[model samples]
Each structure stands twice: as C-alpha cells, then as structure tokens.
Target: MTTVSPLVAAFRQASYPVGGHGRKNIQVLKEALHEFDDKLESDIYGTGESIEGFQAEMAAYVGKEKAVFFPSGTMAQQIALRIWCDEKGKRKVAYHPLSHLEIHEEDGLKELHQIESLLLGERDRLIRLEEILALNDEIACLLIELPQREIGGVLPPYEELEAISAHCRANGIKLHLDGARLYEVLPYYQKSAAELCALFDSVYISFYKGIGGVAGAILAGDEGFTAKSKVWKRRHGGDLISLYPYYLSASYYFKQREPKMGQYYKEAVELASLYNSCEHVATLPLVPVTNMFHVHISVPKEKLEPILVALYAETGVGLIHYLRESSEGVCSFEVSIGDAFAQIPKELLKRTFERMANMLQ
Candidate 1:
C-alpha cells in the first residue's frame, strides 16, 4: 500500500472547483484511451496515414510548407536551432533569459550543439525591439515565445514584434517561434495562426500544452527545413516506431478545444479581476494576456499549503494543490484556464479567494 501525502489526499477528495483539468478521473482516462482503439485500425508506424495526416493538417494550419511531428518540444527546439546554426554558420541564438532553452534544458544547447545563447532583455518582461537593435553579434536565429510563459504569460506589443521580425529578416537572421501555448494566446492577438507563423522562419507547437494531447510536438517550416528536421529527429531517437496514439489524441483535441480558447482567455481575465479584489492575493501582470497567469499570495509555502489543504477539507474547494515559493517568502502558483475552469462560477471563485484572504488575516 502507498501512502498519499495529506495535500494529495485533500486534492483527491475535494468536490468543488480546482485548477486545470481536475486530476483526470478514471472515466476521462478511459475515454482518452478509447481514442487509441479507433486508431488501431489505421497505420501504426510513424510513416503511415495517421502521422502524415497530423503533420499535413498542422502544416496547413500554421501556414508552413511542411510540419514534422516530434516526441517533445525540447528535442524539436534544439534541432530547430541546430539546423539554423548549421545553415547560418553561426552558433549563437538569441532569446529571453527565462526561455525554456536557457533555464529548463540544463545547458543542452551549449553542451550538445555548441550553441551560444545570447540572453536578451530583462527577466519578467517582454523582449523589446531595442534589445534586438543592440545585438551586434552574428546569430543563427532569434527565438521568441508568444505569451512568454515564465513571466506570467506576457507578450510584446504587436508592432514591436513585427519590428523585431523585420529586423531579423533584414539582418539575415532566422526567427523561430516557441509557440507551445500558441493556440491559447491567439484570441488575444486576434491574428490567425498562419498570420503569426508567417513572421517566423520556423515555429514549434506542443500538442500537450494547449491542445491537451498526451504527448508530442510539431515543428513547422519550409519543406527543406522540415525534411532536415526529420533526419535530426531520427538521429535524436525521437522517431518512435508508432506515433498513432499521440497523433490521434492531438488531432482530436485540436479540433475539440482549440476553438474554445477565446472563451478560456475571457474567463481568465474575469477570474484574475476577482483575485485582484481580494487582500493578500493578486494576479501577476494584473491583466492576463492569455489563458494563463500566476497568482501570488502573501503567505509562505509552509503556511499556505496547510491553509489550502484545510480549505479544501472544509469547503470541498481545492484552490491550490501546490505552491512555489519565491525568495521574498511569497508563494505563487500558475492558473491555467481550460474546460475545467469553465465549470467554476465567478462568484464562487471570488468567494474562495476572499475566504483565503480572510484566513490569512
């Protein structure tokens, strides 16, 4: 028998609204698994109709000449950078300091590809046009993340992004988009997916993040670029024997949930507004530019976790399952609005935070 932590137990037993997807019940898991049953009659390998269908659909949707599926965004991004570096004969790539490549990849870019990351702009802010203008070093590519995830889903102004794109083009530097949450952020920009991808030489999108797939990523670019990426995907051992499950789930969710992102973004803004009204709890960025934002609480994690657990135990509302502590003793957690969030009433959400704030007092 395994022992469940008190916090985990609280989350498991709660009946009211909780964050993001609400712990995938057995029924939900079965439903997702059944998607594979339908796919079993189709091609099983990476070479067949199922994988090719997803790739073609994604390419057309992103306005790329081609799209290649990969097992993970980390592999896709690293390979994209490697391709650009090899083509440009320059090893440097520029992106924000908080980029997944810089912080999460554990220096794989430097160690594996000998790619030098030129950190651009200040942390917790959008990379500005002036930063691009100031870069004198010859670089392979400029990678930009829409709704920059690390900084509360912040995005640069549309004009600034266009200027940066133009600058990169004029300077003969390639541009790649780390659009893991691209679908979620599209409603705010009011631009079609293709319009946005048109500004970049390459774009990488995660099937799991916004699309709610089990796992996979798509790299979209020109046919030549995608062809090269396929070779690299094989080299990186990302070429799975069969990708039907990932493709089927990705394709299914892309159709079902992608259209609802605008509603999610609207709900996020409304929810954040409610948080701002409470004491000791605030939404980072004050306004959400996308469907995700961070909630910063004035309580330390050690103190806050118990409160969350207690609240859930008493009220059946699991407000937070976990909290990340900052150096200043404040605790923060990300709130990503999706289908689960739609079920939560705005008034109840407001009351929950109000209760949390009152408890702190």
Candidate 2:
C-alpha cells in the first residue's frame, strides 16, 4: 500500500482539469483501454505489427527514413546525441541553456555518454543564429528544442531557424530537434511535421506530452541512425518486452488530437489574452505561439497556492496544480491547453482570471 499526499489526493479527485492530463481518472483509463480491446498484442521485443505499424506511421509523419520507439524521451535523446558524437568523433553538443538535455536529464549525457554541453544563448529567449556562428569549438551536434519549453514555449523565427540549420549543415554538425512538444507548435510553424523534420538530422517527440499517450517517445532519423539507436536502446534497458499499450495509445491519440492542434493553439491565444488582461496575472511571452505558456502571478506562492486550491473547490476550475516561486517572490505556473481546456468556455476562463485577480488583490 502506498500513501498519497493530501494535495496529491485533492488533485486526483478534483473534478476540473488540473494542468495537463496528469490526473486521468479510472473512466478515462478504461476508455483508453477499450481502444486496445480489439487490437492484437505486439511482439515481446517490439517487433510485432502494432509497434512496427506505429513506428512506420510516425516516421512518415516526421518525414524520416526510419523511427524507433523508446520507453522514455531521456533515453531516446541521449542515445541520439551519443550516436552523432560517435560518428563525428566530437564529444561536444550545443543547445540552449534551458534545454531538457541540459536542465532536466540529471547529467546523464555527461555521466553516461561523456558528452560535454556547450550552453548557447541567454535564458528565456530564442537562440539566435549569430550565437551559433560565434561558437569556435568543434561540436558533433546542435540540438534545438522547437518552441523551447522552459522559456514559455518561445521559438526562433522561421528564418532564424533555417539559418541555424543551414549553418549546422555547412559545418557538418548534425542538427537534432528535441520536439517533445512538436505537435503543439506545428500550427504556429505553419509547416507539416515532415517539413520541419527535413531540416534536422534527427528528431525526438514524446507520446505523452501533446500526443496524450501512456508513456513513450519516438526518435526518428535516417535508417542507419535508427538502426544504431535500436542497439543503444537495448543497451540502455529501454527495450521493453511489451510496449503495445503505449503504441496503441500513441497511435489513437495521434490521429485524434494531432489534427486539432491548430484549434487548441487558437484557444490558447484567446485564453492567454484574457489572462493578460487581468490586473494581477501576466503571461510570459505576452502572447502564446503554441498551446502552452507560462502564467506569472504577482501573489506569493504561500498565498496563491491556497487561493488556487480554494478556487477549484468552489468553482470546479482547476487552473493549476502548483506554483513555482521565482527569485523575486512572484509565483509562476504553466498552462497547457488540451481537450480539458477546450471544454471550458472562453468567457468562463476570463472570469476565472478576473476572480483570481480579485483574490490576489
């Protein structure tokens, strides 16, 4: 038996959306399970019809020669960088300072792969092409996270992104896209996944982030890259015996939600506009380019957390799960619009922000 914290319990039982789909209930689980009721099982080592079918579909979706599924994005991306480093005989890779590989993966690349990270650009801004050009060191790869997540989902201008990609190509550096939130930004990019992927040597996307899968990631690249990745995947213990459930959920949601991301992006813009209008709340980036953005509240976390919890209790609107306090004592939280947000009327969201403003004052 396991014990759950009171806040965790409240979030789980909350009737409203609490950030992303982290609080999926039993009914939702059963519905997703029903989707796989009619499907046959995949192979023990990821060779069966369902797994191969999803990988092929994703490869075609991203315009890659091949795609391999990994149990986690951490494994997929580290392996991708390792492969590029091994091929080029350079241990250095450049990326934004806030990149997941740098900030979130707990130095796995440094410890496991012996890869050194060259941090590029300032925090909370898109990496400029001049920043890459100024680097004098030899590097095997340049990892770019489209709509960089930690910086309120900001993206480099399309022209700048193209320039960077061109520079990487001219310098013989492999460009890999950490497109964990790729689907959410496609509408803003106004390009198909394939078109964006065409610029990179490899791309990594998460099944659970925007795709709403159980848990998995797809690393797509040329056939040789994917073949080598498969071996590394096994070496890294990501070769699960049965990954059919993740495959089925990813396939189902990719079809169901990928097509409607543009609508979600639009909704996010509308909601962000309303939030920005509030007196005490401000959205980072000032406007949203994708379906995700950061919300900063003037109130301290000590006060804002309870207000949010009470608001959910009284109005059945779970605006956020928790707040991350900044150095200045202001609290910031992320808003990721999805099916849950699509259900709420924009007027109601506006009112919610207004009410929050009143509470903070």
What's the TM-score of every candidate structure? 0.94, 0.93
lDDT of 1 by residue, 95-203 (tens): 9999999999989899988999999989968887888977653888999999899989988887787888888888898999999999987898899999988999999
Best by TM-score: 1
Report the lDDT tens digits of candidate 2 across residue range 235-304.
Answer: 9998989877677777777888899889888878887887788777889778899989998878777777
Clash count for each candidate, listed in order shown: 0, 0
Model 1 residue 284 distance off true place after TM-score fit, in angstroms: 1.2
What is the RMSD of candidate 2?
2.1
Best by lDDT: 1
- In lDDT terms, how accurate is model 1? 0.84
**Candidate 2 similarity to native, TM-score:** 0.93
Candidate 1: stretches off by over 4 Å:
1-4, 24-29, 33-45
